[model samples]
Target: MSTIEQPRPATSPSADWWRQAVVYQIYPRSFADLDGNGIGDLRGVTSRVPYLRELGVDAVWLSPFYPSALADGGYDVDDYRDVDPRIGTLADFDEMTAALHAAGIRVIVDIVPNHSSDRHAFFRAALAAPAGSPERDRYIFRDGLGENGELPPADWTAAFGGPAWEPVGDGQWYLHTFAREQPDFNWDHPDVREEFLTTLRFWSDRGVDGFRVDVAHLLLKDLPETLPSRAELAAMDRTSGTHPLEDRDEVQDVYATWREVFDSYDPPRIAVAEAWVATPERRARYAAPTSLGQAFNFDLLTADFDAGQFRRIVTENLAQSAAAGSSSTWVLSNHDVTRHATRYGLPPLAGREGKQGVEWMLAGAPADGVDRELGARRARAATLFLLGLPGSTYLYQGEELGLPEVGDLPGDRRQDPAYHRSLDQGTWTYDGLGRDGCRVPLPWRASGASLGFGEGAEPQPPHLPQPDWFAEYAVEVEDGDPDSSLTLYREALRLRRELQAAETLEWVETGSEDVLRFRRPNGWEVVTNFGGEPAELPAGRVVLASRRLDGTLPGATTVWLAP
Candidate 1:
């Protein structure tokens, strides 16, 4: 039986809240500075609760604040119940939760149930115990399993560029999907499942409204022999591949277990999966009413800039949901990869080079930049495409400002683990520029050094000089400027909130190869032109625009039409 209290009929989003709700994801380390330290913490986040509310987001996904070694940027948790010292103490988290709740914004924290940092006490105990010992069984420990009994378990590779298996002595080997310092948890073990359940309860009891499950599909894998090919494994040596982490049948079981536990809480919490798989069948299974409320659709992440391609991606997702009897949630980008600005319809930057010209053109700028208008126009076009889509959209930090990837971090100063991995693998030619650029701290104000993201001045200046036009593009500056991108977002959000638009979305007609159209259940039309040429739109009151579509939207643009 669900312990969640059913809200009064009038309290439901079907009547009010959800419809066009926006979720702003805050990578705490880069959101704001509270202690004069360059790092952003819970207090800094707490101070900005109102800003999120003002931005019209109904929820805020606070990335992991758990105690960690900072390896893999806090995904390697040393403890789950406490806040990291660098971020703050548990008390700060309590205050942050209270503050966000008071302001009407729900809080979602990242939960890493798939693995833990090697420094974690549980891992320490497992290491100290003998092979086959009760504690050792909590992890994937096996003796006498390698060739000459000297190699790792099977030939699985690590997502961080090496063998997934590492020796733990005693002739035993352990698995690590990512960094060696982070050991994968044995979800097959009953104890592992129990411990994670307790961790989930600890946060929910403390008022976390939901969780953005970290690499949720990594809970299980085939037993060495049945794993993907060495060639296939090597190709994904740098992704959440290496071992088969996702679209695995066993992952659904984990979601079912967590869902049962979550249902015991009040207000009915939500769970989201960071699934980057194309197996929509398996993806949908995780969204069963008894499982997670949301799972990311990587189709858009891999989508090409064509009307047919876009339609297929969106339609396939919707069909998958209907077939599986599940609801859907959408996202543009998160903290893990390169920013969308550099991912689609843009030029080759860092992580995207050596791929294809299309990838650059998708996230890169058009050849013509008579002025900065080309970049600005591309930014608006991307934003329109993002906002005009159906389902819940995740706004990565600083993406609303059309910020590009940071191209200036010195090799020594680079903070991403991917860069270090590339260097270790002798693939040092790869630049430290990709996603790192989009992950830099949010430039809150441009008055002083660090751009007001920290107290006084930062040891380093803000990444990419602050956009001077922010005087016109910023949230503070655009509340009054109806034509600003920030203002446009605000208006789009408001229009989406209008009762009729909050329901499900449906694709109506996509006539023009360059122009695509979809209808909101509320009778609003969302249209776009991905081509680099002007395209016509059905005449209607324009609520959102890639360039204020008065007649034709320029190449790579979007506009919302309402009768």
Candidate 2:
């Protein structure tokens, strides 16, 4: 409890700092390990303060570290106010928070408001209580359909794939949009709504800068006895549409209340909603000034490497965000998705919708159709382009190292609920491929028994296997390589801050629609070549380039030039 690293005093509001901040996401379990258990812990995060400060990020968004049964990768939060014992203690969190603040980096912890682990005290009590008990009122529980109550209450399917309803015996069932282990909360309940507000104040008081509201749009108004049909659900009604179970109008009130709680604090604990809504316009509501203040724009995350696609994604996102008076965000890879390096490297289909279907992702990323080198190159160029944009940037942990998805993960050892719950008529579908590949523990050293994660000498294997090739992207290996992706990112981030006194973007026509060329209000421009042959760079002094410049910008390359 030394004063030197204790939480700093709150300051005046940060005046919309999130609009242009660079937020790095740290998937706690995969970030770094402290206990010899091979899983990352809070103390481990405290140990990385210098590295985070060195990266020049404004804040770190720590993914769920709440107590859980590892169902749905800790999104099945059992407790809102405390850290899991396996990860570390509440004292560890406070220390980590203080340590991060001491480095001038803020903290944004994940808050899974939509659901709770079935093992949670309330959920367990609800299961044991009678059908109409107040305990059952805290969760969505209903009687089954068939005569013997053998059928689920509705035909609704879980996001991961199986039926959304889980049997609780006694002819009753509970609703879980994700896995059965994660039972959705009854947002209609006063206790549920008030409890989250308390949770928010608890963390804000603990010195967290913000909350990354998980599944921010999935909370419900109230669950009716009958549910909407699949066709009705598919018709998004111009994207502002709310589904019967998922999105509803009342959820807006939930966010408004949370916003009030957030702003009540000095410096105002800000929030970014992880709302996967139907349209960009819908997503913007979560970022409305009176709401979470920011919402993640994920269009780029699922987009192909084609230049045209990136332009359209950014343009559309910007328009939607502006129309709603909210700033846009850009992200490439995260713990939940297949890493961008792998996505961009795969061979494109002749006329298919996406680069490829979920098949390649589910099939261990077979080498037959992948070009790792090509993918890494696009990923590097893409980051440069994003840094040149006019809004906030979110960087997934291993992206700076150009880590490819470890798609060859053995199925037997996988822990993502998507793999185990995606059962449709007893056949495993493409959706069954969970996000284990991208969530593997990060490598800190080029050679170590635990990649210098935590365990010394002898250690338990990481929850997910790390491919031997991870060494190439390990901190020890890339720290010394001038041309490494790690170096490129550090330099790009530094220059981004210097170049982004800009609030507006001006398109620098490069003749070809296939080349992305845009200049910020400052005299710096970012040109990325995606088409065949070389795209000429605009006349300016070179600041940085994803690849060595040989007079012209080569395809899959990007460069920033200063006036």
Candidate 3:
């Protein structure tokens, strides 16, 4: 159950409040910097409690802020129980939690159980111990294939790029599904499982309302004696659990156990899985009532700004989650992907597995690769459509300000390990940008060192440089604009709290394939026009809209109507 206060309705708010909530994701380092360190810390988050409350979100999901070398943007966490001194301390974290709770906002922290930073004590110990030592058993260390054990054990590739195995300069190799700095834990080891449960309770006791399980679909790999081709594994269905690395069947037992630890607390803590399974059905498995209880539906994230695709994703995800006795989740953008504002601007790429445009995304705005205005309009429409749905919604930081992807960020300043790894391997799979474009520090003010992100009297350059164009999307500028994306998000969140009392979604066929319409049990209607022509407004009062609405809803627009 969500511990935050909700608008009282006929339904009990204390029961499964996350089923219909607005959760804002705060990437700490980019959110706001305090102490002139050019790195956002816990104090900055605590100071922003008022802004969060004003945004009308029920909860905030903070990305990992633990001690790290920033190898993978803090996803490579060195410790689970404490904050990075560069960011803040454990006391700072406690204060942030208290402030958000005082403001009636629940807190959910990121947890990476799939892997551990090479700097983590366990990983360090494993590295120091002999190849056959117990410390090495804590992680997935194996013998190499070559006679000298120089070559990697298998042909498995890292999700980022290159070989997934890293040699310890000894006779053995260790598996790291991501960057070499993050070593995948051996879940078969009892100590590894116990340590995670203890870590969960540690933060829960400190008042974290929930957790966001990083790479939830990846755990408990099935290491076959005979390694399979990476291409063959890629072609296999993720739901089948036959792929040696992802969505393994044994991972279910782990969540079932985690559910027990979660329920032990009064007003039991909740968790949402960042699972990227092949289908809604596979994703739903991670959110089963006895599991995490919530998982992201990313189909919509990569979907083109089309009406039919949105409807199908909603229908499939909702039905699947409901069948699993869990609430659905809708997300447009996050730290890992291009922001929707830039994504919707790029034309759809057909031969790429229904993925949205990317060839243009890496082009960095040469000639006319991006249609920014069109993307923004579609993004606003798509967001409203997402908010009108009957489940929780995740809004990435800076998304409220309509921040476009910083695709042109200089190569020297790029910090994403995925980008460097791909480049080093000569793969350049993400066109050399990787995830850095969307992970840029947010712009708060029109001008200043780091765009007013720091509270220090002396300005400090942000860890990542903010572009000059960011001034147009600064929160300080948009906050006062009535038609700004910030305004749209604030109003939409506020009204959704007021009208989204029912979980049932009824389709309102608009007689056109390009137009999508749906109604709630409370007589509220959400309609979007993807067609070239304007869609006639249904018989209801215009409550709110992505753009100003008239007698009819214009193309690339979404509007909410009152009974």
Candidate 4:
């Protein structure tokens, strides 16, 4: 009964095409605007397939573009079966999918199963229906405490910065681990589980290559009585240890069911989890053969810009993924956090741990003493080092042009719920809590009404403003510059495909501890110098260097060598 035509058997490099693939993450609203609406849509995305293809990424992982009221920036889903009208329709998505496929790039859509927009039909019905009705059962609704039911049922805090419970007018409250407008689904309910399965198939039948499961670690939670205090939760180590609301063992069961659905197709679909669990071992569980195919390994993303830290994390990540019988995932930047260029420029904070690293980077005053040129140099070196590794790599949009976080975004134009929640709770200041800095629209051209993001004169202004300096890094400006970051990324990706056949990596001992040298099975070696001085390159012909070299790998630079 599916309207989609059966896909041709994949002519991909291998059945496990995800392995060794370089995937680009595209935030739809900011990518391009084909309709002159200022917001990037599926048509805009379709028009850019060739750009991505030429960029050398093997796949594109689009952020949520589903129907929503724009709460939490489309993470709040009102309907799972269709696209938001602001972005495009189902037909537009289909067209984009076909275009990407024709360009030999896989399409991985974002799926938010942990919660639904309060405006979703089921959530709306639950609000209007009386307490104890089945409509209410689809979500986690509970009775409030105290004499007038004024107090919340639990002490858990929202990830966005407020109480996790939101009261519905009828003396009952619903759980929302994030913004209040996004009501958490009761995964324990058969109806909720069945609905997600149907939604998964709805897209699968439409020929999406795979899905990226958002907040994959938070599908299950302990009973309300067992919820921990905010302080205790904050102090908990996500790298290890159990949490009432995160990385619960029961969540694997959910993915096991999803795995069955994924395998039903001829080529079998793939899925990667946005799971932020403690320990690489625990993170690997989500990528086990019977569960999701891959889980994002953020060890590299969270590691300090130190040689020892990067080496240790890379070793740990690879070992854990090997134990899980899955390939590891590497990523530098994503929409939710500061771009790596800016992060590298800022001094590392002491005692900062997982997820806190994001906050630490955001809260720090970059204006006081950030060396952006140094950050760009290091980021470029890191990109070559990341691509040289033996696994999948995810590139955030605009990183190719070395975009730095726009830390000075005006408060009024901010959109992240975290920013508003912080103000409402009298917690952190709004200056760093919001994520608008990293979500600014890409500047496609050096100059235009909207930097060539939208077509024609009188094009709509972007949802966010592009800084004047954006013109310096625009795609058109860097397109022909051989030394530009965009050129470096394209060349690195091209060379990566040629050098990626090697499945094993062996560490090469360098005299200095600050230098990391690794040799691939294919006689290709990657050396990164993180010390105060230049390091002698390994005895081989230089294939590519992050920056110009004078017969030595400069400090904060990386080079790929062919023996």
For all predicted structures, in order, the TM-scores are 0.85, 0.94, 0.95, 0.94
lDDT of each: 0.67, 0.81, 0.84, 0.85
Judged by whole-model lDDT over C-alpha atoms, candidate 2 comes out at: 0.81
Cα lDDT tens digits, model 4, 171-230, are: 889999899999999888998899999998999999888899999999886665545667
Question: lDDT by residue for model 2 over 41-147, one digit each (tens)?
Answer: 88888887777776678889999999999978889989999888999999999999988877777889999998999988889899889999999999988889899
Candidate 3 residue lDDT tens string, 344-376: 877674434322344565555421578898889
Ranking by TM-score: 3, 2, 4, 1
Candidate 3, residue 542: the lDDT equals 83
Query: Which stretches of candidate 3 lie above 4 Å from their native place?
Result: 1-13, 235-237, 351-367
Worst 10 residues of 3 by lDDT: 1-10
Worst 10-residue lDDT window for candidate 2 reads: 1-10
Best by lDDT: 4
Task: Candidate 2: list runs displaced more than 4 Å.
Answer: 1-13, 235-242, 349-366, 423-432
